[model samples]
Target: MRPNIVVIQADQMAAQALGAYGDPAARTPHIDALAADAAVYDRAYCNTPLCAPSRASMMTGRMPSDIGCYDNGDDFAASTPTFAHHLRAAGYHTALVGRMHFIGPDQHHGFEQRLTTDVYPADMDMVPDWRRELDDRLQWYHDADAVYTAGASQATVQQDFDDEVSFRTLRHLNDRVRANQAAGERIPFLMVTSFIHPHDPYEPPQEHWDRFEDVHIPDPAHPEVPDPAQDPHSHRLRAMSGFDQRETTDEEVRRARRSYYAAVSYIDDQIGRIRERLETLGLAEDTVIIVTSDHGDMLGEKGLWFKMSPYEESSRVPMIIRGPEHLVPQGRYENPVSLLDLMPTLLELAGTDPEVASTGSPEEEIAPARRGLSLLESARRERSGRSGPEDRDVTIEYLAEGTLRPQLTLVRGQYKLVVCPGDPDQLFDLVADPSELRSVADAPEHAEVTASMRAQLEAQYDLRGLEAEILTSQARRRLVAEALQRGTVRHWDHEPDPEQRYVRGDFWGALQHGQIRIPQGGAEGAA
Candidate 1:
């Protein structure tokens, strides 16, 4: 029997904010506990540092560039197959329970069922205009509101949506267990129980807020903020988000940090509940669990509060995997990995050959076109107390709402290279200077290292070509958005199963029987 797969995806969660990732200020006990038993990737990242692009990359096991998912409004082209497509072809019951941020009409890539609609606008709302005036902030840009009014709230739209996500997912698990028992069969399932939290609005439950008031939250590494000339991309992002226009106090920053911490804790608690339910059903050992985030938030790092930047805080994310002990390994793997690796890894765990059925291909055309390597064998080696694989270069990209150009990154063991078309190249020796205080690109001593990294970046991406393509795509999307908003709009948001059936309401009080027609099994409503 194949192991059941459960992926707990959190939104806008940074590695630096997690207790498992060495932030003492965090109260993520459930995440830490999962980290203890799993093989953790210390230097994991998102292929593209945004919600829709990263998720589309994750589902397809291909880079965002390969699929042309450069921004949130970009469609996950219909022909594009996802992980669910591969798993379902192999007879697994696949389902999505929460936010995947899929744009366009075909919401379910291959999942047989979707429990709820996406929380954010699923249309062209995320598209950016390349022609907009410089320094002109969008109406929806991240502002000082979250930081100034940061505090505990009993409930938020985010909390309410996630509550339904959890309740429905747990209910699905229970129903599946009972059905399988009745049929005396072992039907495998793949469930993605995703959550949207720790993202923004910097509000969590009051209980979680009180849990972190006394705890010390460290100031950002570059708390003084960088000069516009020194770090052009950071400066551009700050301006784009309207952060440069307002002055936020230290107290506000602290409160914002506290609220973010509490939000993470809230996510931890939800994950714990899901895990416990699986264990209660005796499905824990039979399931392979993977936890990750779409992308990381800056959270005021370098005076930036959101993603869409190449900085570590905005790009690096957490990737933790746990499964049957005998079937898998444990301990941290230092070799760099990203969400791109998840699709192949999931296929491998389900007793399928990743090389055979690449996530984006149909079963008959089982060719290996994956850009990421599976870590199953290496993770097993680590569990048996053997040395892991050598450090390798991991690539990250950013081309979204923030700036006029694209930012591509290449991260090796200790070196991080940022390749932006307009700005000067940046090279950081993370071992010597973790905060990236100064660039070593101009240093004579590390000239060879810089050359090699730049060559690697050039080989991996055509920066000039991508920039042109991104600009063209943006213009077309903007025109389409304008035309669609003229009169009646056709939205792509998923409409979940409706509530409040008419027959169930006040039938006894009215004493009037209104004849209602029923839809037949194979046809429309019968009169």
Candidate 2:
């Protein structure tokens, strides 16, 4: 019998916010305890720093760029092979409880069932013309009122939503176990409990906020460098209207950091509740629990607030897997791994073929052209104190929001190179400057290192068949214009509306009552 799987994924969670990962202010006791029984991957990264693409990559085990899911609004091709589909075909009951961000008609593409649906903004599918005409743009929360009041210092915005998601998940788990027991069938279920907290609106419950009030939040290891010669991308962020000139005050930064930590603690408490329930139901030993995040947040670091950068603060995430002692014991692997490895890894653990199937229509080609080895094999090798043949240098690439060119790529054994698309390159020696505070691309003394890293980056681009030519200034501007017109463009400066103010929650209810036009197209209307 294959072990049941429960993947608990959090949105926009940074590794530095976890106590196990060395956050002095963190209080993730449940996750820390799970870490004691599981193997923790210390250097896991997301294929894309943003939500939709990163989640898409994890579902497909392919790079976001490869699938044309380069930005937030781009929908995953429904026909693409997904890990859940593979497991479902292998006779496992797979279900997604929250926040899949499928963005299209075929939301439940792989899973046998979905417990919740359409948690993202409905306007994501609005027609291009309608999107262009709208003054609010793609901002969902702009029309809604703030969830937290001006005088309220607590992180109440996110707590209510997080609690609801957790409640739904626990109910599903308990019901599943009860049904399986009554039928005398072994429960081979794969349930993904995804939470949308810590992503934005960085608010937690009052209790959680109070817990971190006295904790000291440290500044980023490398503060903002005012050198124009450093990296053009950093300068680009600094040049944006609200983002460029904005510097977070120490009090505001501390408040934001405290809210973030409080969110983590809140999630941790929910995980504890679920774990206790699992133990009470006797599913603790047999079920494998994997906890991770889609990506990390900047949290007022480097004068920047959100993800979409190649910096470690945005790219690196936390991954902790617990269960099946014979398969994986308590340990920590520092080997750099990408969240793209999760699909194949989970399939392997479920005793199913990790390989994608080749049989499907043109619209349903449910297999990957290129696939990597499963991380489970690496875990086994690590447990035995041996190296796996699958162990090789990993490369991570990032493309700026509107630009089609690669903004950054890091080769594991070598150095990291940041490309400005049409500008000069920036190189950082990982050994010397892990924080990437200095650029050595122009330093004559490190000519050999620079050449080596540049060559490696070029080879990676060549292998991937990415366009090597950079976009012209006019072309870049046009691309941004097109993105703005398409409603795909997103600006982080606009604060998210408070959770209580989501009009969609009530608007969706109204749709059922025939209060609004049952438009020609799906949820967001014609487009």
Candidate 3:
């Protein structure tokens, strides 16, 4: 039987904030335990640092550029074939129980069922205007308020939404187990339980907040990047988020960090709850659990408040896969991988050939060249000592709210090259300078490496062409968003059926009301 797949995702969770990823202060014992017995990816990154684009790339196994997912409001076409679609086609029951930030009309994408409506709007309302000046921050963009008001809260919209997410997800797992047992069958399932925590507003429940009461929450390693030395992108992002307009104190920073940590712990507890349910239901050993996030938050790194930058704090995310020991051997892999690889990895785990599953309607067709490397194969290569830095290279793009032109990054070997049109190229040797405080692109000795990386970047992406396409997409989306708001409006937000949300009677009446069977020698059973 195919292994049941469960993906627990946290929104805007940075790898640096996780205990499994080497943060000693994090109180995520559950996630730490899972990492202890899983394949921990040390250099995992998101294809795009923004929420919507990153998730779109994850779902489709294609770069955001390939799918025209430039910003949050960009529409994810109904024709797109996601990993859930592939698994569903392979006879797996797929469900999304939480926030995916899916924009456009088709909220389910490919999941057979969406147990709850998304927390964020499923429309083009949050679209960014690239034609506007960077200093003119969009009202929808991040601001200094989230950081200034960071603290323990009695409750928040985010907390309420995540609570419902956890509740519905656990209930779904229970129902799945019960239903399968009643039918005397073991149908495989894929459940993506995502949470909109650790993203912003920096306010978690008071209980989670108290988790870091006495703990010393360390400040950002490199907090105050001098204005003159700051990279153009970072500077622009800071300005775009209105961080430059206000002065944030050390107390605010610490409080925000503490609350963010608490939020992560809250997510960890939800993960624990799910794992506990799987164990109680006798599905632990038969399930594959993958924990990750759509993108990482800057969390005041280098004075940046949020995402939309190429910095590690905003780009790198945690990728931990825990499953049957025999199937997924415990190990740590430093090879670079991105969210794009997740689609192929899940398909391979479902016993489906990615190449074959990738074939579908012309609108759903995934170009083989655009597919990501199978992480299972990557693990095998690493275990056999056949994996090298050259085995995989990750590229990230950010054409979202912050910048005038598209910013792209190439992560190859120990070097990271950042390039943008009309701006000076910056390259950092991550091995030598992990903080990326300095650029070596102009260094005399590393000229060859710089040239090779630039050539690779050029060969892979037509930066000029991509910029044009992004501009056009931005203009069209803005026009549509404006037009849709006029007169009678039809919103694309998903309104989950209230009647079918809980236990209810079907056409047969009262579902399976009191269908109990008493065994002669055993306890009572459900008929």
The most accurate candidate by TM-score is: 3
- lDDT of candidate 1? 0.81
**Model 2 alpha-carbon miss at residue 395, Å:** 3.2
lDDT of each: 0.81, 0.65, 0.85
Instruction: Give the top-scoring candidate (lDDT).
Output: 3
- Candidate 2, residues 1-527: lDDT per residue as tens digits? 68888999998889878988878778888999989879898877776777777887788777766665555555467778888888888888898877766643467768876765445642243222211222323443111111121112343435555677788788767666655745567758889988887766665677777886577767655566436655555555444313443455556666666777777887898889888767656677788999999889876566555666677787889989898878656688766677878887888877866654212222443322123446666666666767532344445555434233566555454366666457577777767987777778889987886787666656545533444322232244345445655645553211222333224656875343322223454333211
List candidate 2 stretches off by more than 4 Å: 122-157, 238-241, 357-371, 382-391, 400-404, 444-449, 462-527
- Local error of candidate 1 at residue 463 (angstroms): 1.7
Reference-based lDDT, residue 156, model 2: 48
After best superposition, candidate 2 residue 175: deviation in angstroms? 1.6
Q: Model 3: which residue pairs collide?
A: none
Kindly give the stretch of ten consecutive residues in candidate 3 with the minimal lDDT sum: 518-527
Q: Give the TM-score of candidate 1.
A: 0.90
**lDDT of model 1 at residue 306?**
68
How far is 401's C-alpha from truth in model 1 (Å)? 1.4
Clashes of each: 0, 4, 0
Clash count (model 3, backbone only): 0
| lDDT score, candidate 2, position 20 | 80
Ranking by TM-score: 3, 1, 2
